[model samples]
Target: MSIEAIGAIGAVEAVEPAALGVPAAPVAAPGFADWIAREVGQVDATLATSENDLRRLATGQVQNLHEVMIHMEEAKLSFQLLAQVRNRLLDAYQEVMRMQV
Candidate 1:
Protein backbone atom coordinates (compact mmCIF):
# COMPACT_ATOMS: atom_id res chain seq x y z
CA MET A 1 0.00 0.00 0.00
CA SER A 2 1.08 3.58 -0.65
CA ILE A 3 1.37 6.51 1.76
CA GLU A 4 -1.93 7.85 0.46
CA ALA A 5 -3.62 4.57 1.32
CA ILE A 6 -2.21 4.67 4.84
CA GLY A 7 -3.36 8.26 5.20
CA ALA A 8 -6.79 7.38 3.87
CA ILE A 9 -7.09 4.59 6.42
CA GLY A 10 -6.54 7.13 9.19
CA ALA A 11 -8.35 10.02 7.52
CA VAL A 12 -10.44 12.38 9.62
CA GLU A 13 -13.40 14.35 8.37
CA ALA A 14 -13.26 18.14 8.38
CA VAL A 15 -16.05 19.85 10.25
CA GLU A 16 -17.56 22.97 8.72
CA PRO A 17 -18.01 26.00 11.00
CA ALA A 18 -21.45 26.76 9.53
CA ALA A 19 -22.70 23.33 10.54
CA LEU A 20 -21.90 24.12 14.14
CA GLY A 21 -23.29 27.68 13.95
CA VAL A 22 -19.86 29.08 14.73
CA PRO A 23 -17.65 31.55 12.96
CA ALA A 24 -14.69 30.19 11.05
CA ALA A 25 -11.31 30.87 12.58
CA PRO A 26 -7.83 30.50 11.26
CA VAL A 27 -6.48 27.08 11.98
CA ALA A 28 -2.83 26.68 12.83
CA ALA A 29 -0.92 24.16 10.79
CA PRO A 30 0.74 21.31 12.63
CA GLY A 31 4.30 22.00 13.72
CA PHE A 32 7.26 20.06 12.32
CA ALA A 33 7.63 18.20 15.62
CA ASP A 34 4.00 17.12 15.54
CA TRP A 35 4.27 15.96 11.94
CA ILE A 36 7.44 14.04 12.63
CA ALA A 37 5.95 12.44 15.71
CA ARG A 38 2.90 11.31 13.75
CA GLU A 39 5.04 9.90 10.95
CA VAL A 40 7.19 8.05 13.44
CA GLY A 41 4.09 6.58 15.01
CA GLN A 42 2.85 5.37 11.63
CA VAL A 43 6.20 3.84 10.76
CA ASP A 44 6.29 2.11 14.12
CA ALA A 45 2.82 0.71 13.64
CA THR A 46 3.71 -0.55 10.18
CA LEU A 47 6.81 -2.25 11.48
CA ALA A 48 4.85 -3.90 14.28
CA THR A 49 2.22 -5.19 11.86
CA SER A 50 4.87 -6.50 9.50
CA GLU A 51 6.56 -8.29 12.35
CA ASN A 52 3.31 -9.91 13.36
CA ASP A 53 2.71 -11.08 9.83
CA LEU A 54 6.19 -12.55 9.72
CA ARG A 55 5.60 -14.41 12.95
CA ARG A 56 2.35 -15.76 11.67
CA LEU A 57 4.07 -17.00 8.53
CA ALA A 58 6.76 -18.68 10.56
CA THR A 59 4.16 -20.57 12.57
CA GLY A 60 2.37 -21.85 9.47
CA GLN A 61 -0.59 -19.66 10.31
CA VAL A 62 -0.34 -17.51 7.22
CA GLN A 63 -1.24 -19.14 3.88
CA ASN A 64 0.52 -16.64 1.62
CA LEU A 65 4.21 -15.97 1.94
CA HIS A 66 4.02 -13.21 -0.67
CA GLU A 67 1.79 -11.12 1.55
CA VAL A 68 4.21 -11.45 4.45
CA MET A 69 7.11 -10.44 2.24
CA ILE A 70 5.21 -7.43 0.96
CA HIS A 71 4.50 -6.29 4.48
CA MET A 72 8.19 -6.64 5.33
CA GLU A 73 9.17 -4.55 2.34
CA GLU A 74 6.60 -1.92 3.21
CA ALA A 75 7.94 -1.69 6.75
CA LYS A 76 11.50 -1.44 5.43
CA LEU A 77 10.60 1.33 3.00
CA SER A 78 8.73 3.34 5.60
CA PHE A 79 11.71 3.09 7.98
CA GLN A 80 14.10 4.26 5.26
CA LEU A 81 11.87 7.21 4.44
CA LEU A 82 11.65 8.19 8.09
CA ALA A 83 15.42 7.93 8.42
CA GLN A 84 15.94 10.15 5.38
CA VAL A 85 13.54 12.73 6.77
CA ARG A 86 15.45 12.68 10.08
CA ASN A 87 18.75 13.12 8.29
CA ARG A 88 17.48 16.07 6.28
CA LEU A 89 16.06 17.73 9.40
CA LEU A 90 19.37 17.24 11.21
CA ASP A 91 21.32 18.67 8.32
CA ALA A 92 19.04 21.72 8.20
CA TYR A 93 19.47 22.24 11.94
CA GLN A 94 23.24 22.01 11.64
CA GLU A 95 23.32 24.45 8.76
CA VAL A 96 21.21 26.95 10.70
CA MET A 97 23.48 26.60 13.74
CA ARG A 98 26.54 27.36 11.59
CA MET A 99 25.05 30.57 10.22
CA GLN A 100 25.71 33.85 12.02
CA VAL A 101 22.68 35.80 13.23
Candidate 2:
Protein backbone atom coordinates (compact mmCIF):
# COMPACT_ATOMS: atom_id res chain seq x y z
CA MET A 1 0.00 0.00 0.00
CA SER A 2 1.05 3.58 -0.65
CA ILE A 3 2.11 5.95 2.19
CA GLU A 4 -0.86 8.23 1.45
CA ALA A 5 -3.31 5.32 1.84
CA ILE A 6 -1.66 4.29 5.13
CA GLY A 7 -1.94 7.87 6.42
CA ALA A 8 -5.64 8.00 5.48
CA ILE A 9 -6.24 4.66 7.25
CA GLY A 10 -4.54 6.01 10.38
CA ALA A 11 -6.62 9.18 10.26
CA VAL A 12 -9.88 7.23 9.94
CA GLU A 13 -8.93 4.93 12.81
CA ALA A 14 -8.34 7.94 15.10
CA VAL A 15 -11.93 9.12 15.06
CA GLU A 16 -12.92 11.37 18.02
CA PRO A 17 -15.70 10.60 20.51
CA ALA A 18 -17.88 13.35 19.02
CA ALA A 19 -17.86 11.51 15.74
CA LEU A 20 -19.50 8.50 17.47
CA GLY A 21 -22.60 10.69 18.14
CA VAL A 22 -24.00 8.81 21.10
CA PRO A 23 -24.12 9.93 24.73
CA ALA A 24 -23.23 7.36 27.41
CA ALA A 25 -25.83 6.59 30.04
CA PRO A 26 -25.13 7.02 33.73
CA VAL A 27 -24.32 3.81 35.60
CA ALA A 28 -26.80 2.67 38.24
CA ALA A 29 -25.52 1.41 41.61
CA PRO A 30 -26.27 -2.20 42.59
CA GLY A 31 -28.89 -2.86 45.28
CA PHE A 32 -27.87 -4.27 48.68
CA ALA A 33 -29.33 -7.73 48.02
CA ASP A 34 -27.67 -7.91 44.62
CA TRP A 35 -24.35 -6.87 46.10
CA ILE A 36 -24.65 -9.41 48.89
CA ALA A 37 -25.57 -12.21 46.52
CA ARG A 38 -22.61 -11.43 44.25
CA GLU A 39 -20.18 -11.31 47.16
CA VAL A 40 -21.59 -14.51 48.65
CA GLY A 41 -21.27 -16.29 45.33
CA GLN A 42 -17.64 -15.20 44.95
CA VAL A 43 -16.78 -16.33 48.46
CA ASP A 44 -18.57 -19.63 47.91
CA ALA A 45 -16.57 -20.30 44.76
CA THR A 46 -13.30 -19.47 46.46
CA LEU A 47 -14.13 -21.70 49.41
CA ALA A 48 -15.05 -24.55 47.10
CA THR A 49 -11.76 -24.25 45.23
CA SER A 50 -9.81 -24.21 48.47
CA GLU A 51 -11.64 -27.28 49.70
CA ASN A 52 -10.85 -29.10 46.47
CA ASP A 53 -7.19 -28.19 46.79
CA LEU A 54 -7.11 -29.42 50.35
CA ARG A 55 -8.64 -32.72 49.28
CA ARG A 56 -6.07 -33.12 46.54
CA LEU A 57 -3.29 -32.37 48.95
CA ALA A 58 -4.56 -35.03 51.33
CA THR A 59 -4.74 -37.62 48.56
CA GLY A 60 -1.15 -36.96 47.36
CA GLN A 61 -2.45 -35.74 44.04
CA VAL A 62 -0.75 -32.36 44.19
CA GLN A 63 2.29 -31.34 46.24
CA ASN A 64 2.68 -27.58 46.17
CA LEU A 65 2.63 -25.93 49.59
CA HIS A 66 2.78 -22.44 48.12
CA GLU A 67 -0.22 -23.07 45.87
CA VAL A 68 -2.26 -24.36 48.82
CA MET A 69 -1.32 -21.33 50.89
CA ILE A 70 -2.30 -18.95 48.09
CA HIS A 71 -5.67 -20.65 47.67
CA MET A 72 -6.25 -20.47 51.43
CA GLU A 73 -5.44 -16.79 51.48
CA GLU A 74 -7.79 -16.12 48.57
CA ALA A 75 -10.61 -17.90 50.37
CA LYS A 76 -9.90 -15.94 53.54
CA LEU A 77 -9.94 -12.59 51.75
CA SER A 78 -13.16 -13.40 49.94
CA PHE A 79 -14.83 -14.40 53.20
CA GLN A 80 -13.65 -11.20 54.86
CA LEU A 81 -14.94 -9.06 52.01
CA LEU A 82 -18.33 -10.81 52.10
CA ALA A 83 -18.56 -10.35 55.86
CA GLN A 84 -17.94 -6.61 55.50
CA VAL A 85 -20.63 -6.35 52.86
CA ARG A 86 -23.11 -8.19 55.05
CA ASN A 87 -22.36 -5.92 58.01
CA ARG A 88 -22.85 -2.81 55.88
CA LEU A 89 -26.17 -4.10 54.59
CA LEU A 90 -27.35 -4.87 58.11
CA ASP A 91 -26.37 -1.40 59.26
CA ALA A 92 -28.24 0.20 56.35
CA TYR A 93 -31.36 -1.85 57.11
CA GLN A 94 -31.26 -0.85 60.73
CA GLU A 95 -30.83 2.81 59.83
CA VAL A 96 -33.81 2.68 57.46
CA MET A 97 -35.98 0.97 60.08
CA ARG A 98 -35.12 3.67 62.60
CA MET A 99 -36.26 6.47 60.28
CA GLN A 100 -39.38 8.34 61.53
CA VAL A 101 -42.31 8.70 59.13
TM values, all candidates: 0.73, 0.64
**Number of the top TM-score candidate:** 1
List ranges where model 1 is wrong by over 4 Å: 1-24
- What's the TM for model 1? 0.73
- Provide backbone clash counts, one per model: 0, 0
Q: Provide the lowest-lDDT 10-residue window in model 1.
A: 9-18
Q: Native-vs-model 2 lDDT? A: 0.86
**lDDT for each of the candidates?**
0.93, 0.86
Error of 2 at 101 (Å): 1.7
What's the residue-level lDDT of 16 in candidate 1? 88
Model 1 agreement with the true structure over 1-101: per-residue lDDT tens digits: 68888889667688788888997787899998898899999999999999999999989999999999999999999999999988998999999999998
Q: Please report the candidate that would top lDDT against the real structure.
A: 1
List ranges where model 2 is wrong by over 4 Å: 1-32
